[model samples]
Target: MTTFVSIGSLTGSIHPSLSGVLTKRKTVLNCPIHGDYEAEGIYLGSILKTQTKCPQCEEDQREAREAVEAVMRQEAIKKEVEERVAKSRVPLEYRTKSFDSFRVLNAEQGKALELSKRFVRGWEKAKAGGYGLLFLGSCGTGKTHLACSIVAALIANHQFLFPKYYRTSEIFSAVRKSYVPGSQTSEDEVLNYFSGIELLVIDEVGVQKGSDAERRILFSILDTRMTSNKPTILLSNLSAEGLCSLLGDRLYDRVRSKCVPALFVGQSMRKPATPDLFD
Candidate 1:
């Protein structure tokens, strides 16, 4: 014979120890479907155990889960709406111009823009999936404008999407100012915001000299996004060689792995246009 012990009893008359002994010897433990009903004396060691829902408990759990899911869905929708609004607010002139419109720009720049469009469109096809593109080129070559246009198209399609634009110098300075040895909450918040955005556009990369600590923050953000397969767009005057010079071999390698590197070649489009606008 084997000795067994019970834990507690539902009815006042039955001893908990006896209940445990019966449950241990006859009923199954940790059985979500049958354990509760079996303990109530509804099924006394029957070959086929019957399952009865605890109406109050079941309803409560169901309602709680529904409440959480409802809130999450609402938050997602709200975020999407906000992104659309922000993108819409960008000037029409900036958003309308695309790779095709810039006649002065070279074929490589046009190809780069097409690649970027494909990357963004691919993300829309898989909304839940995170992916990103990086545009590495000198200033005045329409990197920012193209990024904004892509965001505009996504918003126009009424997709749940958003683009977050940041200057590398701004990020570097903010991360540096927030550092106080152990306090990284501000830095974490920045990283969290960056990670959640559907697209991240970083302009003027290598514009600022980064300390070791600053580089660490940048690495953390990039690593987390890369691991999550989120899309990132980098706009810089630096070439691939220049990036290697600035960010070092290790970090440059990480960036190269995710990005389809493209060179933007042209006279500075930001310069005052000639009388004909194309000369």
Candidate 2:
């Protein structure tokens, strides 16, 4: 006699005798997708009867699970990027600035942002010939804002890079700390650490006077990273000529040879808190 599995009876309120019969030799199932198969099906609670789901159906379920996992992994990566961008800034002012909050009220600012975005998109290609970005202008022109926005965009979009940001003074401060006796961190170690980053951002390029030692340290950083095809971004309240004077030809030459320039000429973005200063 042909055997048939009453899926509803097996999955529904089970009689005591049904349980005894089920525990015996495996029951056979006839599914539309896989024809006949032997099953030692698990007792699913009142909600579902998957006795019809044969080995082929289980394979389909496995594929569905893998697809969901892939989507979850992508979301995790994006969340990590957002977190790192929030924490990357050294100055507190630009920490919260994002591309959305940045105002593009004029064409120059718009172009600056456009170029910054292009830099982020072509970053993988930069590792061969190297790419540098120089943001030059007076204070409050949003050069630093645009540069920070690039970092946020890059972290959100790319997986390989972890970038660092430093003001010109911070670069000196960081090196000075390494000079302390028994600190176990040498000056070369500090320079090498910054140089090895996938992207290095230095702000306020001409903010202070530079010494021969400072120049050597800075040159070592830019030269090492450039030869390895790493990218760097420099922000300043100075023009190209001003930076040339501030960093000197040896260092300035390296910057000029590799970097793309953006000039910002406007009133400071940092305004007085009083309303009258604006009006």
Candidate 3:
């Protein structure tokens, strides 16, 4: 026969054989471990349901919720950053952009992006390793558009750690100005910014003249990134030969080693890039 008893340690069903003795001993059968005593009590779930909650399960749920919240927060931040990047890009007004209205149109621009993606993807394969690409062609060949599109994609699709876009002269000048006498900024800060980025797109390369001093600073930035294995995107109007003439051997060879040059050959895409021209 089963008997129920309320005693010191027993709060639920108690076997008749042990009930009287356990009651006299101030111990109960089927008693759930209370809050503090939960760890010490040996009770089944059926009895413990009336006692204290399972702390282990409670802790697990809390952790799981926190993890889910963390993931959601990260995804939100990533989306925000991508939107900002897309907005900050140069408007299609100044140029005919193949990446804007049509990224996969006739699959031509898509093919270009795909070729570029192969290099960028390599960096991801190596835990963010690999170098950059130098897109050299005449103006209106969609070099800048492709370069900016890459920055957009890396920020949008790839979730690259931190991507930055700039004209070659802008960053080169910034680094140089920082080293001038009484300047508030330092060279280290410039290098730190360039070095830390996961991907850097430098457009209009060879468009500006660099003093020997500026050349040295430019080399410093490129060499540092190369050694650290950060990828860079170079868009320039200069031919491979012309680039070698302008940047000199050191920078040339370094860029040459890291990048696969894609020569854009076609009539100027800018002459008539609008739908109106087709009419």
**Per-prediction TM-score, please?**
0.58, 0.72, 0.59
List ranges where model 2 is wrong by over 4 Å.
Answer: 1-16, 19-78, 275-279
Cα deviation at 270, candidate 3, in Å, is: 2.4
Residue-level lDDT of model 1, residues 96-182, one tens digit each, is 555456544688777877876786567654344444556767667777777776666566455555566677777776665557677
The TM-score of predicted model 1 comes to: 0.58
Return the TM-score for candidate 3, rounded to 2 decimals.
Answer: 0.59
In angstroms, the error of model 2 at 194 is 1.6
Better of 2 and 3 by TM-score: 2
RMSD of 2: 7.8
lDDT of 3 at 111: 63
lDDT of 1 at 276: 91
- The 10 consecutive residues of candidate 3 with the worst lDDT sum are 20-29
Q: Which ten residues in a row have the lowest lDDT in candidate 2?
A: 17-26
Q: Once model 2 is optimally superposed onto the true structure by TM-score, how far is the C-alpha of residue 273 displaced, in angstroms?
A: 1.7
lDDT of 2 at 125: 73
Candidate 2 residue-wise lDDT, 1-279, digit = tens: 224444433535767545422222246777798788776544433223344448778988899999999999989987887778766763567766777787876777888888887887787776556887999988888898888888888877766667888887888888989989888899888988888887889988777677887777777888887777788898988888888887778778887778898888767778668868668
Clashes of 2: 1
